[model samples]
Target: MPLSLPERPIILTGDRPTGPLHLGHYVGSLRNRVALQSTHQQFLLLADAQALTDHMHDPAKVSRSILEIATDYLAVGIDPDSTTICLQSHLPALADLTLLYANVVTVARLERNPTIKDEIQARGFGRDIPAGFLCYPVAQAADITAFKATIVPVGEDQAPLIEQTNEIVRRINRQAGADVLPEAQALIPSVGRLPGIDGKAKMSKSQGNTIPLSATEDQIRDAVRRMFTDPLHIRAADPGRIEGNVVFTYLDAFDDDHAVVADLKDRYVSGGLGDSVVKKRLEDVLQAVVAPIRARRAALAHDPGHILEVIRRGTERARAITDTTQRDVRRALGLFTLH
Candidate 1:
């Protein structure tokens, strides 16, 4: 039910199969997952159940995106050998854990969770909030505690989920008289949130501002060209502000050439830097970053059997580990076990 010291720390992170992951995911968590696999024991969950919280109406979209999301993972170099790629719906333990955790965490606490509150407002759920939607924090605690994940990669906005998970950990341990769940630390990425191509603060598929991982060359170019820039800086001689400018932000995140980006920023601030010039630079940078991922995702898409097999193998492995955790939790909580 809880984590023990292993040779390497356990990290549990995943994406909901609501849509294809985009540049926001690439910079925020995908790159870090690639690097962490070698040194840490990682489990990448295909969170189809969690996807259902809001997407229950359109099951087809979620189903289609499962393969698409898995393809994106392999396309981005997440080795199955190093990282276990598991399906959330396949793990019964998580459902059991969620139910148990719900009994411990209060409704008022769930309502007060900032991340859930923001999402509720964003989705306009209001008083009509889906019970599952309101219970996302509990489900997330289950996901984290299921594998006894000690290191969870999350966005800064998601830090509260991790904090809530630890709170459940403490309460469960108090009842169980043992550490039945381990506290997870949020491992935030260095690069912050990538703005939408429209210059919105958040990039999202639902918002139609996302550039998907499978975006084509033309799509990539079109997105970069349409990127938001300083309206006042219409002329090449006029100074531009980088604060809300999406092109420079992309450059800052994607362009590895510091001196070049620095020069561009200085010129943009002072004057004489055209939006088109910086846009071209961003387009080029994005092309290089997304091209390889697109190609790999295409190749992976051809073999549905292979992707299924990988998910199958990893899910089977995860089932055993999670089953053990369930038994531990049930026994710890003093729940009667027929077995």
Candidate 2:
């Protein structure tokens, strides 16, 4: 008889526990996770090991941010009952799978990954890049295949990583002479990317441009006040350009009132709307979104013990799934000898 498949697809997605998640993260994946959890078996990973690929000097920071990322997950309405939040380092199976998958991929392939290249340039690590950081794509493949995840939600820039993962999956199955691992498809977000307050193409913690999900009202207001706008619009009478306007980009992503935002865009271009007016509107929209998240984070903060318990439970559950995958992999590769 053929095997039974799950009614709902399994989804694998996560963030590096290097810092608090930000507005960019919410727009990119968090909102989608909240909506998909009830309909799918979702596995949210706290990728501490991957974070260490770059931040090896500060292991303590990774430890601290595990709870921070989990709280953000819960604050954003990723219910523990519906979503299994797992820590990447706790699953030794993932490490083993990563090693197995790495054998199938060439150094040339890893070097050619666009996401990896962009990261190497951004971090200014020309020749001094860590080998673990360079091979993270394989580790990510392990994370996805271990859960047999059919769908992976990620940003547009990460689409290349998904492609690399599928390549490894195909190579491994062909080598093993069986379809042992499932291939995953990337579910790219509609609002694919969010720019930094400084008008950079991406918001990043290293750039110091992110507005954290747990930010206070004052912090939100301050970030908004400093947001980049058209530099040429010197006065209220001057026509403003919107080609690279970060404020308008943010408004398009966050503000729900389409007609109102459209009107604001028209007024700004035609020469009467001031930057302050647009910034205030963005500030209001962001505060409305983050206020409830902030409140929930505050409440969750009061009970660190509860947060740790949740992580422990999810870690145990994730380990069992990965253990099965590891056994299958070892057997397929003819490495499972009787002890």
Candidate 3:
């Protein structure tokens, strides 16, 4: 039997257990998750199943990161008592809904999705894209609707997935002639996307440019030292451009003192601040931010049993909610259930 949902706005947001979540994940979504868990019913899905879309050959890595990312969440102050942290593979209804949704969205429509196109090109899959990779948006739709998630926190690049989820919701609701699934809204964080230290691309695990949640003090300082700044600003008196400077960008994202960041930016642009000075400030800030999280992650890593227990309990709770939705969706579509 399925459990009943709490009477509140339900939020479903998570990360693929592909790697240790980085500052990008924190700035983009994790911070918001921590805040929303207090006001909304939240579920953090360690997306092991979805991670398999690109990592089918490395299932072990996917399984391993489940614990790593769950620890990341806990270290970042995501209270397991507040947020239900579930493993995606343990939720059978998600796969069932994915199969059902696959029939709703056309292949051409999937090909036309901008997010899907960008990912395929970035991965260099060309014409030989994996079927699972191509159909992940459908899978995401299932994950969202199965929990009846009304709000899905995501980055700007992922807004298309929420739209696609709504399209599926409309399709299913039409078949059922009622609102069986609530469409989810993409709540983009104010910080947007955090770029890598090189300013080449977004901070990503695959790009090897990420500062992990468990990054060491030395690693944090080193990453900040190498952060991209204006090449033209060769000396302390040379005017530096903050337009593409990754340092200011991170400062803006992480540093709480807006006035100080503005002053630094002004000095940088007015030909007085050196890159080292700016980098030093950023390094200190990042060190402070990452030190506590690193310690918490280290402590959590020592207790693998505690991590497993958290995932186990959350998965069980999530199964009930998703199972209830699955049965409702089945009934709405007029599919006969084995009662």
85-169 per-residue lDDT for model 2 (tens digits): 9899999999999998898989899999999999899889998999999999999999999998989998878889999999988
Taking every candidate in turn, the Cα RMSD to the unseen true structure, in Å, is: 1.3, 1.4, 2.2
lDDT of 3: 0.91
Query: Model 1: which residue pairs collide?
Result: none
TM-score of each prediction: 0.98, 0.97, 0.97
Model number with the top TM-score: 1
> In candidate 2, how many clashes are counted?
0
User: Candidate 1 residues 1-339, lDDT tens each?
Assistant: 344667899999999999899999999999999999999999999999999999999999999999889989999999999999999999999999999899998899999999999999999987999999999999999999889899999999999999999999899889988887788999988898999999998899999999998999999999988989998898999988989998988898999999999999999999998888898888899899999999888888899899989999999999998988889889988999986
Q: What TM-score should be assigned to candidate 3?
A: 0.97
Candidate 1: lDDT over CA atoms?
0.92
Which parts of model 2 have CA positions greater than 4 angstroms off? Answer: 1-4, 337-339
Candidate order (TM-score) = 1, 3, 2
**What's the lDDT for all of these models?**
0.92, 0.92, 0.91
Cα deviation of 312, candidate 3, in Å: 0.2
Supply the TM-score for candidate 2. Answer: 0.97
Cα distance off (Å), candidate 3, residue 112: 0.6
